[model samples]
Target: MRRATTVKFKYRPHPKQLQAHRAQVDELLYGGAAGGGKSMFARAEAILLCLRVPGVRVLILRKTFKQMESSVLPKLLEEIPEELAKFHASRYEFTFKNGSVIQLGYLDKDGDLENYQGPEYQLVIFEEASQFPENHYSYLESRLRASGEVAERMEALGLFPRRILTANPTGIGLMWLKRRFVDPYPPEKVWRPKPSEEDPEPGTRVYIPARATDNPSLNKDYLKTLNRLPEDLRRALRDGDWSVLDGVRFSSWRENKHVLKPELFPISLLSGRKVIAVDYGHEAPFAAVWLCKLGNGLIIQYREAYAKGLTPVQQAELIRDLSKDEEEASGEPIEVVADPAMWSRQDAGAHKTKDGSPPVGSQAHAYQTVLNRRPIKANNSRIPGWALLDEKLRIREDGEPRFLVYNTCRDTIRTLPTLPRSKTNPEDLDTSAEDHLADAIRYGVMHLEGKFSNLDGLDDYVDTMDPMETYRIAQAEF
Candidate 1:
């Protein structure tokens, strides 16, 4: 028989951590700048609960198992003395001598929620909680349940089932987290809470802010790294400023300058080439945006249509109808530019059209057959496309932005301001966001080829040189 040995672990809490550790709230958040020991607090809190309350189940998680191993596993191991707590490697769980369990899990995707349905955890710790969606947080908290003696012991211990969320001030969940917990409440202030429509969990919740300075022992190099981040990121990780709003890319978007109400729009001013931009999706979302670029480089995004599960033929017909009014109002011929993927040939199963003939496998072919117009393949460069979108969002000294969206394009207007920046490449939009409208806008704007930009000065170079030389210089300037 193996002998049982107990190893003790000790942890000293910083002031912010202590506030969170002592919180009697149903949901507690200890978040702010990086190097604030945000993650360390979650680890210590999990261990303490398991040790004090026998048979208590503590679940500590990050967004992915890879994140758990890389960020939490090493520190967690040092805190575990491995005494009588037998760790099951496959389960990624620790079964303490007193029947308590601490399980390390990852909620990588929404589908992973099913794995946790049966476990009634008493304490749930979200490490870097900002990386998760609000729905994930709510779903997990709903699973915080216990019955019988385990519940009695928990009651006696004065430990009601609770959730501890630790994060820096950034990620996809930034806005929701800020709205739910961070912004309304001041640091260290607890609320005697009531249920709200957005967050109906009944219990007190509090925000205890953490800063890099809070952890005197946090590495100088890590602090230096945080300081070196971009202005918004630096403010978030170093100063812990929630007002900076990190996830959104289009901070320059102003409603007055960019939105054109149907009654206010001057449809008669649209005298240049009109374009219908498309992004094709069958199971996901398909989007088409109608745009009219004026000769003065002004671009008006006048209309849009977005939906999912539509065949290419259906999409083409929808686009035709959506653009009919605008084309007639402006008395301008409209050209079509579609996503490059729309031209790809499909297999035998691709024919989704009613006719027994070939499936409308290629969206461009379908457009040609039905609308009698083949769409020009759009420029698909993501980075440059996003830059072009940024150019449109920029407001001039006249307080008029080059890009204007009609109030009719509700999806485009709604999705643009709420799109989160990609964590992997901060410069890009998070692809997981509902970005079909943005994609359609990108396809259209990129196809305009920067002709409507502030590059009209290039025409002057032509007058100073020979015809051939001037054309060469103009192309170079362009």
Candidate 2:
């Protein structure tokens, strides 16, 4: 009699991979430097889930079909033992004898998600998730539900619904992914999501940051190739530095050297001019940055207010409230510089009054009415403004940057470094990205640069009032 053959499969996962497999978080982001074996880890986890739990259904996604076929599919096929599972090429799925299935797919377009509407997946893995848009990712998150039977089976096997994502720092979805996963907590630290109105059923989130050095299996030649890449790409891929992007607009931005601790530069030391820069948006996000110029020609971004869906009056009130303490202490109003677009009147559709009559005035005028002062129009010169800001970000001979952002300015710190260069216009930043805070910073920087450039002599202007009052007057004049 012919004996039945038994196939034994074994996978020795790296430490990071083991951590990811053991993590009980609902959503886990395993990202960072390239060649860290992220894809291998994802494939192994997916296979294990399919093998251990009957009726387990997993959806593995890539940005493009070709990518999924050429890279992920080949590795998956190589790893799965022949006797354990059968690959159905037509459906792009693997079926194990235990009734579990692993479906390989791609989401290349915005509307691609509609194809997956009815299917519920116990595990959804997004490979190169940063390449996908935020809306697509959120839509996929809604489909991460399991049937009662499947849930019961998974629970019996110590498995749960998991959303595993792997990505690098560069991509269109960089901002939202960073905000959602990488920015909340330190690497390898698991935290329960805080409940919020928008996210009532928030789940546990974890970030596992890996570097090229972490993967000993990576070939030395491949390491050399990564090292030989341009400075930005090298930092992003080799060092796993999220702050640096491939085509970053602000090459001068160095977070470690440019960002300052709040204690080091206290609000009490804010002696120079104070300026508030606003980039208004109702549909997108409205961003406001408060900058304080010190006596040593250092411009410190101390505070920020970034929100969306607020009316002009609401934004004005928020700005006023944000600056209230400083304004009171200084005994004068802080200078407000805003986007030039705010001055343009809008009477087309939504701007109409309750009775369908044209609205009273422009957004800037309404803001002024609520703020009790007219905000000066920003220079709105993109190239020059960016140049000035870039110059300010440069480190001086004394090892101090001319411009420094306080750690509290999270939006600015997060968005500024990630802003990419415009493909059409290399000189300017890509405005389509999350550039509101960067725009505000540019406006503040331009205002300061323009104000100081016209100054004939520093000694000519003198004030008898206290330093705060004098600085306030100077700001108002500017």
Candidate 3:
């Protein structure tokens, strides 16, 4: 056996780090704004755990291999003293003389979970956990089991298995992470999971929110850099507000301005032209939004149906049922505008229809067959559609937004505010988020804009120039 070498390092953890280290929980989320020293805190905890427990195994994971190589691995090397462990470059791990091993791992794609199939670790840390989907995070939790020998050693040392996740409040996984970690408790409070069917051995889960102010060691320039971010991004990163997200396409979406009380917009007043905008998805969410043009030219989204795992026929049935009463009262067919992708019949395999004949090869065809009306294909241009929606969402000089959503349209109201900006096209919305409702809204708004002229009576309340054109001009000036 190799002789144990003396390990020496000094780490003065701030209050947030101290809270994280002292958390006695099965899962702990040390997350919040940028410059919170989350990465350094995770490294220190992994090192201290390995030093105290012999024959222990720790797995530290980032979302991508490039991140593991560039950010995580270099930090581990700098923090762990030379005398403590031997670096095995090939394996991307550090093996200490006391038999504890620290593995630096990456899980970028779905298939990357295969690399950690049988390894058991006493502690597993997910750096930037919000960057990964919930399925990837769930699969990783199964690998947190310990071997019998490791368990015995842990029992002797009075230490239990733990999974630590550190992240900022922006990513594709933000919604689920917020529901899991942040939503469970008030800020800075420790939360314990109650026993449930899914979680039989309900373990303590704590969330410790830290901000840029929590770490005095952060450079002033870095704080300034964070502050210099866009308004939504600055709030999410600097203030760690989960309700807001970075790169939001509809920055003007305020609950007070855009969302209306159900009683405020009576359905009786929605007697004008009505439309149903559908964004079809079987694996992902299928969104159908019911919108109507009020006489005042303000668009109200009064009803919606958003769900997943339903066949096109079932979706059509649900949509018909949702609009049944409204259609009956109006005695007129509600126009349907759907995603252009639904109109494609190419390569769509066959299925049995209700009458036992071959099914229509496309979603649009199926909906048309069921509803007895061919739906209008929406203008799917990304930038123009998004711009139209942005125009509707913007509060004009008279303090009235063109678009208003009823509180009963919960999914529409919930998802519209959180849609992030697309990286590929800065002007478009991110499709990875739960953006089906937003897509449906875009389709409805664009179709309405194409069919109807601008509201006639707005001259008294606002300027003659189009608000959207003014917005574009302001953007150009900036």
> What is the model-wide C-alpha lDDT for candidate 1?
0.78
List the candidates ranked by TM-score, beginning with the highest.
Answer: 2, 3, 1
Candidate 3 C-alpha lDDT tens digits along 1-478? 9886655877999988898898878888886788888998999999998888888889999988899999999888888888888899999999987999999999888889999998888899999988989998888788887767778888887789889999888987787787788765766677677878998777778888888889989888988999899887887899887767666777788777888887876888777678899998989999999898777778899889999999888998998988888788878779999887886666766543465432478778788888877788776655556766777788899999989999888777667887888776567677887899988988888787673223334333224445456446433421
What are the TM-scores, per candidate, against the unseen true structure? 0.55, 0.86, 0.67
Candidate closest to the true structure, highest TM-score: 2
Highest-scoring model, lDDT: 2
Model 3 TM-score (2 dp)? 0.67
Candidate 2, residues 324-361: lDDT per residue as tens digits? 98889889999999987886676653443464322358
What are the root-mean-square deviations of the candidates from the true structure over C-alphas? 10.5, 8.1, 8.0
Off by over 4 Å in 3: 1-15, 18-28, 51-53, 63-98, 106-118, 130-139, 152-162, 169-208, 216-221, 230-233, 241-274, 292-297, 320-383, 395-401, 404-435, 447-478
User: Each candidate: how many clashes?
Assistant: 1, 0, 0
Worst 10 residues of 1 by lDDT: 469-478
- Residue 166 CA displacement from its true place in model 2, Å: 1.4
| lDDT value for model 2 | 0.83
